[model samples]
Target: MNARRCDDLRLTGSGGANRVMEAELKRLVMRSAFDVRVPNPKREGDETLLYPFDARVAWVAACYHRTSSRISWDLCSSAAVRLEPLFEDLVPVLSSDDRLPGGPELRFSVEVGAASDFEASPLQLRGVVKNAIVEALASRGVTADIDSEAPDVVFIVRRAGTPEARRTVVGIDLGGSSRHRRGARVATGLAPLRETLAAQLIMLSRWDARTEPLVDPMTGSATIPIEAAGLAVGAAIRHPSELPWRRLAAFEGLPGETPDLFPGTAAKIVALDADGECIKAMVGNLRAAGLTGAAFDQSIVIGQQDVRRLTPERIEALLPEVRDMRPGVFCINPPYGVRIGGERGEHELLDLYDDMGRALARFSGWRAACFVANPKFVYAFGHHPTMTKPASNANLRGHFLTFQF
Candidate 1:
């Protein structure tokens, strides 16, 4: 068993590789029996993935079910904002699928003033919160009539402070898509997600023989990539009961359905970025997850390369070893809003996507998948999608579109 100190938690930011490392720390320690809480940063890349060092604390996570940032000033995302960082503490609890990553401004907070599970609240304030979430999401193109059960993503929130401060905690219902419905609210550190993703990757390897690598080009302090890489390394799946990150009372909230959204057998999954630093960050995260000595050995390889101009010769150079392997899958989660460059990079990305589409078209046997929120990509790819699913990452309501040749 590992012992982590609560106050000793650390957070650092580096471009590229350093970000991946941040993700690694988030995966392991959070999933394990502990979490570390550090000073939270306003920006993601500036924050640290926390892990626990003590056994007395628990972490909680929360987010708005809505996708849009502007919510008529009624729905406050302050809860998710404070909650996202707490996951590193012991016994951190979170929404199964994170919400803030898709570009919706989010926040998290602790549940202060111990109260009974079924505490009463004014009906009016409840309605306001619900309307704000639903309205914001609608702005992002999600139909209010859309199915809410077991969505690919969820937002968890908790309120911490004196009762006079008027704070409340909650999470997106896995059962239905309603802003008014209440459920358990908790915080989670990046650690648990890292482990969960690692476990998923390991299990996926059995059949597909493809290691789906998570790529971060503009790796912020390195939460997403690091956590993703940890999941790639076969980390064991664990719940918050085993670890403690913060404290919160149980909630009498609704539940929703959760299931796998990614499609494919997992052979030849590749994650690439133009920034070598981001590539290194994820690699470090993978290593920290104990992947270097485990089944992921030789199964996952990350490299520093630009997504633009992916010429066949250039592609062959990086993946020369896989020449004999069957045609694989290529998936990219590029910086849609956060790292999105101006027209110069945007044009480059569009042309690169065109090249990607052309490559997939030529390979006919290969499938390329991307998380796209841009119009130009949809126009340039020039092929019908084999499957198009709605999903969220970084608070953005995006499509998980793939082309199967």
Candidate 2:
């Protein structure tokens, strides 16, 4: 049994990706004996701390940042910031935790956050702290190397209070690279959805492969189908062992492999797109994800068909492979004028959505989970979503609409 102190492990993600992140974490905690706490309303930093984390739970999430660091905030002169105390605070935690990388040469970077009124240059302050940290480690006979680009560790310094109560807070980044880059997405379109967001959308759809299959009509770059394929196969997509922190001697016994989430049979998924290029990309993505061979062909059907032109018969024709599977939900991110460089007129887009809605209406018992920036266009479907939730991507605000047929 691992006996190290259960420090709060922080996870970070894209700006609006935290809700699904929290929900995903909760599912993992429930599956295991590990203690996981998702803040009621996650804080502002796009980072959530999973307290008393079990290393085994890494399979469910691959956050933008993960860290066990000392948080010190202040409102003061940037030059007044000291580093010795911060590293001193981290040593105990890093040294005790066997999952982190140890170093004779430690690459690190510093991010400075200042109050609106502060005068000191963050660049200058970073230099000061960096020098102090190097000297501080040297004093203890611990050698260190600093690499600003792709640093093994990242330190964040933020201003907290007014000049009268001046202070700056610092935190070390634990997870080296964003866990969202799960390696499957090699090809992309003009506006490919982020993989993490795609996975989150799939989970939120609540489509079960056992009883119901998933359909992505707009499978741009095939992110949704690829992610679903990963989940269905119980493939350990996120390889935490590749993280720089894994080199730390302190993290001596951390598991290098992520266990499969699903075992036995794979899930049924249909990937469709109007662009033949996207269909090709989907196949390539699935291949990259090791979703090839006879089983993959039996489970996933990739084709090029315009969703607007889809009829129940045509849909069946296009997905004859999964025709008997009875698709449960249409989980998709439909095109918007602003994204993907809309080449068509506004009326054309509305008509397309209307046609899609009309075509889908025939399913009678299927469901829909559509993401769109403009809620007004939803009316074209002639049916309102049973529920709507807010979501964002690429800095564009949007809503996730769920409809029951």
Candidate 3:
């Protein structure tokens, strides 16, 4: 027999920072299918459903225009074209000529780099980038006739690092050396990340109802951690506030659902930053945004606290505080290699990952959700975990690979 041949897709190199993750996922899928207990069975003729190859998977690319973080979104967008030939086979389940079901389009979402014009964002950038994606699809012969809602599969690309093949993405999405009347910034502003992170908590709450006390150990700008805890719980960002409630109710260019406008039982969230300036500004932003529950404080625990050093006794002490007296996993966003922090900070981060892995092995039943730019860290995470499908983050080029234990 031909060894029951199965298909596999491989994306070699960093392709910015995220290419390695994409390749690993391809490996993960192939392994899953080949090692599966039951082979994927073809539909029997009379089973009643016809699969179409007409609708294509849209491979989307996004690079954020600017942010507090360092990612050259523009360079990522420019480099994404290289992925055309490489990513063509991302999904191999359907035939080349298979017709799409009701739709023949597959689209990808890419954020514009901050270096690009932000002024126009209030006007035309969205359309322009959409056009770029359509053309990118054309390069693959997947969508010469692309349109809105036409794609069956959407691929989003964000470049973050120097891939082995595409060395060092030189472009960035931050502002130019000089400021302009119409600044080049990603206009949806910080509101979206805030809403989405909060919504993530909502979804999680639905999944595991018993899990109450939400926590984000390292609350930078206090946005993510606060949102995860719920606007009602107790919110805190790095900056200070003068007019908290008004800022929360203020009109953001992009509107989002704020669950805790009067989040009654606000989380006792503590926003911590090593920089006093950041802490001050965060307090101001929180007040300006009218956030009610945020508290600013300096924290050595956020990124600096080593997981290896956390003893079972220490963890047990806080166990009651985490899930309202129940044991819960610690969710975190570890540093990827870049900026002053991230992986570029010598090998301090790599050692951190190793330590975390060993700690996780000790806490086998603790369900943890860790987002890493490099997915292989999961292997280093000490214990085997169920991995989720990955997504791309603009600030960092690599895909956001999630591991759940």
Candidate 4:
């Protein structure tokens, strides 16, 4: 695509919070050397931010982003609610576009969401939209078929606005499976933290990743530690071949190589949990993410230990290299008392948070970030946080609080 055509392209990514995800995207755009035009923040209840498209944005989001769940290109939008006229308008555009995937059989999937003003059900609307697209492509001399199981391209058809002023949008999904699934942690312990949320905690904590030492005391399945290690080594979360962008002509000549597993300037990372099974799960997950042999020995240490018993002396004994290192990050996703056996009573969970705060206070100069679902954690910990960012963990809403000890 030429520069003017690129300007016509718009993209968006979905994640936990709009503000946090938008901030991360800005950082990624700057690091990738792409000029992006940021759209005004989405209105309340909106879950994504739109930006003028850059091929680098799509490539980096597919392979490197730890925040976005999925990214999509906004193909077209119209005030017309009818499917026929909307797709008919694309016939000329489709004919002239050389970037369209050229294969013997074009496998595709369609998703539809209709507003309350629409009379048709979602399933019926989806069928109408699918037929409209297939007919449109055939008119342009391009053959296409529906393959929901494994599709070369996934299209989204959505309707919005009030009855008087309705708008429909059509977009193509560039992210195939969610970006949060890093293909690691085959065994997730009870109430395990999602990898993307863990990455957000690490980013919010501002850990340098090179000189600092990271410690996760209540590291169930070691999600936070493993994500830290992955980020330090510049690991690609998704293989280049699996990305949907491979089918797009605009992404030609982009770097498709995954970096070798080398802990050149990686920081010292420690994972400690009270449960023995959690430790075993962490080991298997580390191996799955290619952190083994020399990489494991040089940068990571895993052990079973209760959070209350974690102290400066205990950490030094577990990983002696951290003794002289600079203060780093201490992040955790502790129990929320809603799920997971034991600590069902409110008092028991509060006591655990109290003990956790005391243990974390022992590490002078270290920065701490915790994800808590309960509102009482602030009072129980008895320490004012330096900053608190609203976030969500699964179905429950929570906050990520940062502290300096």
Q: Which stretches of candidate 2 lie over 4 Å from their true place?
A: 1-7, 15-19, 29-102, 111-129, 154-169, 314-327, 339-344
Model 3 local distance difference test score: 0.33
Residue 259's lDDT within candidate 1 is 20
**Measured by C-alpha RMSD in angstroms, how accurate is candidate 3?**
16.2
Q: What are the per-residue Cα lDDT tens digits for candidate 4 across 1-405? A: 100111223223233456656676565545553465444443323355556666777666666667666566666555554545554544444445455666556888887744444456667667766776676577656689999998888877666434465556566776665557777888898778888889878887888877788889888877898888866665668767887665678788887765523337657888888998888888888888777687478588888889988888887787775658677789889898775456458788899989988988888998999888889998998789999877777667888899999
Backbone collisions counted per model: 87, 19, 70, 0
* Predicted candidate 3 versus true structure: per-residue lDDT over 150-227, tens digit per residue: 322222223222334221111211111111111111122222232332223223332232343333433335454434
Per-candidate TM vs. native? 0.41, 0.76, 0.38, 0.85
Residue pairs with backbone overlap in model 4: none
Query: How many residue pairs clash in model 1?
Result: 87
TM-score of 4: 0.85
Clashes of 3: 70
Comparing candidate 1 with candidate 3, which one achieves the higher TM-score? 1
**Candidate 1 structure quality by residue, lDDT tens digits, 10-41:** 22222111233343334333433324542322
Candidates 3 and 4: which is better by lDDT?
A: 4
Per-residue error for 236 in candidate 2, Å, reads: 2.6
The alpha-carbon lDDT assigned to residue 217 of candidate 2 equals 82
- RMSD vs true structure, all candidates: 18.2, 6.3, 16.2, 4.3
lDDT of 2 by residue, 1-405 (tens): 111132334455544555666666565545433355444432444433333333434423442211111221111123234444433444443344334334566677776644334344666656655665566455555576778777776655555433465444444444444445667777877667777667767766877867677888888788888777665544554455555445444344655555664466557777889988777787787888777788677678887888876665766665566646464888888887674245467667778788888888887788888778766568887788887777676577787788888
